[model samples]
Target chain A: MTAVATACPPAVRQGGGPVPVVSEGPALLAGIAQGPGLAAHLNRLGPAPRPSLGALVDMARDVDLRGRGGAGFPFATKLSAAARRRAVVVVNASEGEPGSHKDAALISCAPHVVLDGAAAVARALRTQEVHIVVSSEHPSLRRVVEKALRERVTAGECLDLRLHDAAPRFVAGQAQAVLQLLAGRENLPVTAWQPEAVSGHRGRPTLLSNAETFAQIGHLVRVGSAGYAAHGTAGEPGTTLVTLRGDGWAPEVREVAHGTPLADLLDEAETSRPLLLGGYHGTWLRPAQLRGMTVSRSAIAAAGATLGAGVMLPLAQGRCPLVRTAELVEYLAGQSARRCGPCLNGLPAMAEAVRALVHGEGSVRRVEELCGLVVRRGACAHPDGTARLVASMMQRFPAEVQAHSVGTCRRGREVSG
Target chain B: MSEHQLRVDWPACKGHGLCAELLPEVISLDEWGYPIVHEPVKGEVLAMARRAVKACPTLALRLTLPA
Candidate 1:
């Protein structure tokens, strides 16, 4: 296979990091991109004082702040549910999703803002305990968060904030897994009929959200729901942070209004090529499928894909999509938590089938069968996500699959590893 | 008559296949030997499904009222 070098757009680096771009809206990123320490955060966003629990819930409902984690559950519902009992707020900074860098970016640059959001939720719940769970794998992020916490303490914020280090597995970032880690258990998901919001983190109620979600909460409280809603579409209000990658361009974490066109971040010329929207667990959108599509969750869903975790990866040209998909499937197989038989056996089997397809030794029917068997059979969503991604690749690129089986590939070469 | 459904706590299940052997009417073992319930439990077979749930060595099987 031809390993053509992908061209990346030059990014303006601020304070040794990529500056967040806010195109066509007010900036929620405000002062965070310049690697601002706590002082700049205070100056820009000010201290996030806790509103009453009732008021916070009302505002969350009014603005409809969904969880920034891959699953877009309504934040208000989660908060109100957990608030019924003594609840702890958890800031899920353990970003293990491939192609997602917004969480770590927020932690490193504007950690206090994230802390402010967490503190707001804690106050609303009338709990001083707030846990910030970061992956132990990221020492730099740990240091940055610790430094931010110290700054918050020195500022006399009445928060019982604790920093926790969790194993960096993709499933480990799930709500149950994060809660388990916080309770000194292994970072693994457990099947439960009840939502974690009702009983979590040592069986007490818990309000957990992604770092970016908390940051948006801080932004929302600061700007109010109306001001936040002023920027994005009617359905999905407020700005969102998206990790825009692919097409040989340096992946950028951009803060754009919810309804910003996908074409704004990706080249319109390249939109015809299959774009891997969201991350690996996300879906592929065909060229015509993405035309006039906005980056909102509803808009992306309307295009037959999810805006999962707010990741946008447009496939670069001249690359074998099947080969890339096979490689990703292999990676995903390695990432399986192995908590369920279906995920353990099914993902690797599907990956192997894809590998065979990439080598022109397999048929599309085999892949489809594997996907049907794998989806919805795991303890977590990993297997289902992998199945969705693979299914989308097959659905969006049937011609490519047909060509691959005929001993020819779009790249016109054996792309097999 | 109250309708019931079979559920498996996948992590707790160890592919013992006892559930399938006992209640083959609804549960069958996949290629890997894990039990896959073909349909929800209903009618007089509910007692048989309960017996299989009790027979599961890992205690991963359960019958619950359909939501």
Candidate 2:
């Protein structure tokens, strides 16, 4: 019922903040390299690295690349277990996270790069099949990627690159659910006793990754580990794309080096308050603590948070974190596929609790207990992430929650921090 | 080992309290009129869960197995 200001923040505020990565410079926008510049530059035009399983593993190791997806699973580790004969490669473009569009932007602006990565993985695994699952909302983008795959096929890339339209649900993008859909099963989470990665997609070993991860692989292949490592930190090398949005913040994609300090990024974005790092599933950190804070997963983890798909939103002193958290929780709860126990049950429970607190009807202690219960009981990370997001907000905005509890907070008024 | 679970269609759910009314032990009605089915009944209780599912006026509740 509230129509708060959703306008993007200023492009450049005089003495306000540092420029966002998306706007700091022109997007380098590198496509899949056909020839060699660094790494094992092997494509049609480039000397094809004779598809050795060990070589592919070594290549991934050299770059120290991890899944660009939210989980940050190791790419080399995922590839090592996926050498089965019926191995399949899945390019996940479902990208259902709200206020997050980096994957779509990557696919739309540079489809070939993602295709090259998919093709390389298929070639590396000696598999004959590759599938790209995109959201139905982005039909044109899926078309462009499919066309790029066809063009590559004509150029002698001998692999079956299939395009699949994912069901328009948030959890449909989940690894297991996506696999179920790909296998022509119900478009819901699997009920398998075994892990989906090892026994997925018609009882075959499937390698599913975000669209950005595959493109990063293609980039790593061409740039070489050392070259890719040049800009990022020692642990996680390469640039990461982040979606920055909020009041007094322009909504745009930004490419920051893996170890870019959080303070610098916020300064560039011209945010004038404490920031919410990661996505709705991420954490809230003091702005002063952001000083000299690195943006890598390890660093974020060390700081008691995870840079989930690189969604950074800065809440100035006025925007009520309690209200914002409640709104976000409601949105996330609305997006659940409702296939699991905790997510289907706990999220709505938690959302209601938070809503009651925001509307001055509940206690924070009850909300905390609910948060503790919901974190680890889901089939996917939705419940856990939602819990973490809401829990962090509750911790960070105790004052707001207290005010709401005391029935003094005027939630109807247009309030900003 | 089969596990019992609750499933919901978030967009389709209008926060009706019917599911909680049908199965009070597992599902609780929240302030927003949404049912919070905390514990999903598997095996024997699944029948009761299914009955509750059938009783949902909004048709939002379902019994499911874990993935």
Candidate 3:
């Protein structure tokens, strides 16, 4: 019951030119190439029929549909957890991850798909209210969502859809943080005694999922589990949207089937360089680790990395990976909610240590020690994620670390000496 | 009987550091004066941990069993 006075860090606008939807499969982004509108959405994927709660759960379970959000929790498990009580469907469109834009892309290019998914979830849970939470920084996305909701109403959908504007912060998109915003409280995360699915949004059962997850649900309902599972691997089914970076321009949001090879999305010439799978908080994959790795969750997990928010940034040649990692760590440290001690203290300390290492003024052992202290010590996963990024950089770039320590850098520059 | 564990509601904790002082074995203060709990309270220290929980100024510290 303590109120800590903390200022919201200014939102870092995601760079990368307009992300285009490139899909191998015909679901989710079916008519994106032809410029999808409400009409196009309706024509490509017809109006969704209200299915029973049991049926929706069965479909999710049958396809093993995991949330498109970073954690990849199964959708069926979350749905069944909320089935016992009056529930509210929350569409988490707050795309705050720096290199992730699939949610915004979905809302902008195919708002109907997202709306249809939200409405479908509401109908399944027998709740009339569906709240789509987007960042206040993106006014255009808000307009698109509002217009799409109106379009759905005009088309005779009876679900009550609302748009909520969240302050643009990294952790603001976390489940608890979003729920706090809906509760008219400060948009900060709290360690809930009960899961949100059990008691949330005014103590009622709430099913909150990523925007792409809802669109996938809309896709799932339109096409049965068998059809949705047609393209992806056995473990992870359906086509997923990915924000692909480091191909010479801003990251492009592309839709690829689950089993697509990592090589397919990346530049073949740059395969020798380290590939950053997931966004800033995700792990780095060496070229050797990329072999035989597909885009599916199981495959990526087997490769010791996660397809976190499905972001891939191939580090450009001639750029120092450790320097890039230090820069991102600094950004993540600044984005902390500043409520927790580890995040407030540990992150800045670790960021400074990494910066010193980059400039040949710090020790690798000190950076590692700081990372160990920061992991699992914060209220949210922000500290843990930052540690993961730093740890992975240390593991993957030993040569670079040795070079940087001696006052030289991989980019062939005397950064310190 | 289920074993008691020490937990901190981090947002509520303003680094009062009473828990570390009262239950030195189970809790230690970080560089910023916040408690870094060694979780899963041992049977011998459960009483002192309870005292620490009661002694917290902000009531940010709690003793609970695993759910």
Candidate 4:
């Protein structure tokens, strides 16, 4: 609703890509070597009474952890205010952002690590049902995760986790939309209801957080807040898993310490051009400003954007910013569930405007009007966020936008032909 | 909140308009015949909201509380 940007706070720019070696904590590798998760891990912890809602709150607070899910809400506060005891735990594994491969990659590589996190949180919250919500694209991930949970049962791990197939549409990955589909309703719904936290399953409480967040939770528990806080910035501690895609980069999942500099990650990717931070729903940063830009959620927010889902994409110099930005906007629009009045009506209109700009056939008036309609009107941030991204591109890359406008850009070539 | 709201899945609405007839104070039909409920529901409207919800001939209308 309001464009708010805070000036620089704490920041860090580090080397290495995602999956940076976590030097502290209980050693996730140790847990991995035990070769027993769910049940074995539970057995190892042994009869530890589930932390009181209060105790769990304290741990979350002590760690200063935030939602690894894009919002970055304080985990402690989310736990405290969320419906307690009766809440359902939804592990978001949709991995819908084209630039985002972190969730699926994590589950594929270390299924048990994620499971340990899910189990720990559910146990801590005393929730009986844990749903693993994944997309149809990653069928193996679903099967493997399910099989891993099954194995945990043999080791006496509490087996309350269920694998749910969420509609693979991009909009379905939004937190509320994901819940609606899990409720056995259409993936696209007009209203927002709390399924996992409120009236979940048979109308109980629900705690829906992303798969990565749960993995972080698992790390926090094994290492304790103090150990987990050892890496990264003081304001933002621990490791972050990001999906690194684009030029000169090893296209793989990476683990980096929190507050790693954006410049460093791009250097790891070897990207020589501008970078698109935060995925399609994220912002595009020019090469010059990359220096000293940190990766913490707050730091990015201060820069008027976020590192959503920790997605890092690079746009080479030869690539036209206008074309790339337009394509991404249209891609995001097509992903909308078309439930709300604004998303359904607004997105397509914005898409057309972007297309016209791409072809050098758009008017400034049309673009401005479409952008205005895209905010605060959807069940999720898909429409609003996409609009912001496109609008920001238009604002920040004025030279490119003007080039397209005056028929001197790539879009003008088609017109001349 | 005495006044309540009625929502229809536009795809499911089928333009039944039963809610409009059953609860005029809250609902009005659109040009195409779909029901548009304009009344803001409050605490006291829960009973009426429930009635309207049940009365929808197509079962498209629902009464929901904010979380």
Best candidate per DockQ, number? Answer: 1
lDDT of 1 by residue, A179-272 (tens): 8788788898877656778877877888888988898888788878898788888888898888877213665666788888878877876786
The DockQ assigned to candidate 4 is 0.13
DockQ of each: 0.72, 0.08, 0.68, 0.13
Q: Residue by residue across B1-67, what tens digits does model 3's lDDT show? A: 5788788888788998999999989799887899988768877888899899999998888887787
Residue A360 shift from truth in candidate 4, angstroms: 2.4
Candidate with better lDDT, 2 vs 4 = 2
Measured with C-alpha atoms, the lDDT of residue A40 in candidate 3 is 69
Best by lDDT: 3
TM-score of 1: 0.91
Interface RMSD for all numbered candidates: 1.0, 6.5, 1.1, 5.6
Task: Please rank every candidate by lDDT, starting with the best.
Answer: 3, 1, 2, 4
Local distance difference test, candidate 2: 0.69
Native contacts, share recovered per candidate? 0.57, 0.00, 0.46, 0.00
Ranking by DockQ: 1, 3, 4, 2
lDDT of 3 by residue, A204-248 (tens): 999999999999988888888999898687777789988877223
Residues A1-417 of candidate 2 have per-residue lDDT tens digits of 111112211123223433222332112243222111222223322532334678777888887777877888878889988887889999998876655666766665556667767877888888978998887655566666666676677777788888888776667787877887887876666444455458767888888899988877766666666777877777777788777772234556666787877666556433446677777778887655576778788777877888878777887446667777888889888887775555677788889998888878887888887887666545567788888888787777677677777766644443323
Candidate 1 per-residue C-alpha lDDT over B1-67 given as tens digits, one digit per residue, 9 for 90 to 100:
8778888888888899999889989988777888777888888898899899899899998888865
The docking category that best describes candidate 2 is incorrect
